[model samples]
Target chain A: MQGKTGSESWQEVWDKSVNGPRALIDCWQEIPCDPCQEACAQGSIVLSSGICAPPALHAETCNGCGKCVAICPGMAIFLVDRSIGSGLARVTVPYEMRDEIRLGGEAWAVDGEGNYLAEGRITRVSGAGRPGRTMLLTIEVPEEWALKVRGVRGRRKLLEEPEEVEAIEAVEDFAFCRCEEIDYSRLREIITQGEFRSLPALRRFSRAGLGYCQGRFCQSILRSQFLADCPEEDREVESFRVRAPVRPVKLSRLGGEDG
Target chain B: MAFNNFRILQHPVLGEKKNGKEVRIFLDGLPIHAVEGEPIAAALYAAGVRITRLSPHKKEPRGAFCMIGRCTECCMIVDGEPNVRTCRTMVRDGMRVETPRGWME
Candidate 1:
């Protein structure tokens, strides 16, 4: 949780006020994705730290087009126009939830962590793209809650807590690969029993990263596990071997011309 | 809306749900209304239909992880074909899909 949200310095970015609608990017995590930079046509959002870095918003130049709002795969970027009215502002938030709230529909405005702050009305819902990949729900809220509201929850969502996964007793039951249901105990036992030091070897024998995601998620965990097992000057962790048709493809597609 | 309906029928950004050329796909022999261009995984997700695949080793449940067709998690039997990535494959009118229960191995 330490590196989850922004630091104290980021408060300056969040509090940075503008005359019109400004793009607010809440993503502080160092994720290896940056579609938001390309999202802005006015060159408002800049990723000075290459592709993987958090965006640097040039709030002044932003036209509040809400293009970034729709294009952001993270659903993090939003537009806030403070110059709308006296003690009233319009905030554009990317909404992809279950409930159906229409334009001018009443919804509970929620904070960054989804706690309800106040009731707000959807002012402008922009379905901007050819078929917008993401829907931006613009809410007209009190000026005080303009910066506070990040999203809205329907009365149903407001009442429903996300389904929680209950805790089980054993660490052995901890599944390293949710796709394959390969547990830690099985992996550890296999590696220790066979003295398997290689990742590809362990993958073949234990079938940890062979499931869905094709080692995208579990390979890292297995690599870390291998690292934990060793007292070494250096550690060599070779990944799974690449093959033709690397992606999961149907056999029927292989027979087709365009496929 | 059904209590279990997770579909984004109307949203602020996307407006009233207009998925190109409305169609229906069969999932586990049940009719699921879907759009033509969108992948079956997305349609399933909107319908709150998770658990597309199950782990062959232990018979445990699995669902779509990466929406972009790279992962093997969302593989399902589509139109009598086995081991198809539902996340990548678009839903066709009357397309049939079912979880490959025992064949996960």
Candidate 2:
């Protein structure tokens, strides 16, 4: 792996002769979580330092059980089998992207940073006996690219295509009050430039809280902005005034016309 | 024609959406299809009905924000009731939804 952080490298594990298959614990961070250690039946996963230390794998004892791959909350564990066939390697990666890549489908293998490496065929997609959130994808890659490939590019372009709008321009145009159609710049002006010291005064001036929501949603946002610029002495000012009939009541019911 | 932009065909994590019973609802007198028990705002968004109501003072176009019921941006007239929170209200068959031009219906 290009971004391998732990002391032991994947190349060192591959050099050792294992019985069947072995897990490559890629977890570099010292985070507090240990479901992967407990999932292993052979006790191959060792957290020698403590709960927060990264797990170490005993490659000789690990039977490529894939228990750590499924139970790992971080989804950092992978199962690599170099003895699959001649010039072929099988790498089981934690897959949670979507239903885009299926069994026997062509998958574009990617590195840690999602850079395209090589195309691999999806040999298996397993989520059985594991939480529905995380799935395992087995891809047969070239033996040379086995250690380099980390994940498969699955449905990234289709889902994220619509959100390519310029973020800086979008922020200025983003509406703070959907009912009032008040954008961020307009709201900021109302809070900073407007002479309203209190939320009610600002609401009265801007007609922001008077919308159908009755200030339920935009009140907090307005308050934070107001407090951000307002002096410490004026911080105790009252927020938006709440009125009766909080829930929307029908006109007929309010008028008692429908008896 | 029904709008298809907001319709999630297949989600990466949740997989395919298992929508409830399909039902008909009216948006400004135009008949639209929606899943029963889903928020009216979701149906309207799926149909590409972005501007649900106009601001009372400036007539600014407004649509669903904070898909949760907290934001009244998605409010519209539902079944003769003014200021109904579409994001919170569930869709019912033959439900009448009207996007009033201004505050007064």
Candidate 3:
């Protein structure tokens, strides 16, 4: 049979087409990952270049195959059919929790940060992986929230009750630079000094990210505070940590000698 | 302890599926063996290397979490650098290692 013709709708592609799916994958991270590229059987998704590039769809050409949604490593992609007319969007997303959620269960829809914003109903559920690990959960979310709700919390933590965002201790006491052994107090002192009013100056002086792990640990926290100190460089400073062999091992391991 | 008593003798999920070369590496001056290709955190966890880095504040203990790089709980100093995520990085042979303490500069 010939592949999906250009005349078919996205729903027809969802029902019968095997080439591409109408999915919106929200890549909240710029991390190095590319499972989605390998997942597409129809060549519907094109991320053939770098792993960090967003997966793009040829709107007139895609046939709605759901492979990309199931294989995304970050669980950041989703299939949506917003043209269904009731202001209801049928969303197909990856679920990684081991909870016992029933069909039609009401899920507290959340953003990437797990913050609850709206509610959604489970429409369809199927195990999405080879080992039957992750679930490809299809939910009926309000069209307004279709772009907002990236995930759902199946297992509610006890500490998730609504609490005001206040830190009992000043942010300074919280250590952002574990390598520099710079606690919030020391960081505060460094910030208080007229010579160092921002994170770059602090990073330069204390060598905050110059440790072994290459700032994979405290860079985000430091960046947050750094942006707070100097908002002018916020966008540039939010750049991600350049990934290396971020893990630590002994020199003997890389020696290539049979150990 | 007998070899079978190890927690990673073969984990039900991650352990048995790991098919890599077994190699030895040193941690904080002690020789420890780890499976090649797996992240340094799994090897360290198998070898019981807790305290990847000391807290810059009150000096509390921290280890691996969000085994992926999303959570920064597993950062340590390897060789002469700092802030390494032990989970994302694959173990190579003979890499210098260290637990990041504070202010290397």
Chain A TM-score vs. truth, each candidate = 0.58, 0.68, 0.50
User: Which docking band does candidate 3 fall into?
Assistant: incorrect
What DockQ does candidate 3 score? Answer: 0.13
Interface RMSDs of all predictions? 6.6, 4.0, 7.4
User: By TM-score, highest first, what's the ranking?
Assistant: 2, 1, 3
Listed in order, each prediction's TM-score against the native is 0.56, 0.76, 0.41
Top-DockQ candidate index? 2
Candidate models: Cα lDDT each: 0.74, 0.76, 0.63
For candidate 1, lDDT tens digit of each residue in A107-209?
Answer: 8888988788888898887654324456688888887777678887787634566788989786546677666777777877776677665788888888778
TM-score of chain B of 2: 0.90
Interface RMSD of 3: 7.4
lDDT by residue (A1-259, candidate 3, tens digit) is 1222222323443442223237565663456777766776766656535876556554444444667777777776677666565767767778766455567897767776778766778877776333445677777777666656677666476374687886677433555565455667666566555365444556777777765446766677777766666565536643443555556554666787542
Residues B1-105, candidate 2: write the lDDT tens digits.
565577886665666667668899998899998988889998988887789888775777877877876777777889997778898899999999998777565
Off by over 4 Å in 1: A1-169, A172-181, A210-217, A231-235, A249-259, B1-4
**lDDT at residue B18 of model 1 (Cα atoms):** 61
- Residue A19, candidate 2: Cα error in Å is 4.9
Which segments of model 3 are wrong by more than 4 Å? A1-21, A28-31, A128-132, A154-259, B1-105
- How would you encode candidate 2's per-residue C-alpha lDDT over A1-259 as one tens digit per residue? 1222354756556754233456777888889988987888887777776789778777767788788898888878787778776777788888776447778988888788778777888888887333355788888888787676778775355334455665565334565665566667787787777777788888887776766677887788778777877766376789766777777666778898872
Error of 2 at A208 (Å): 4.4
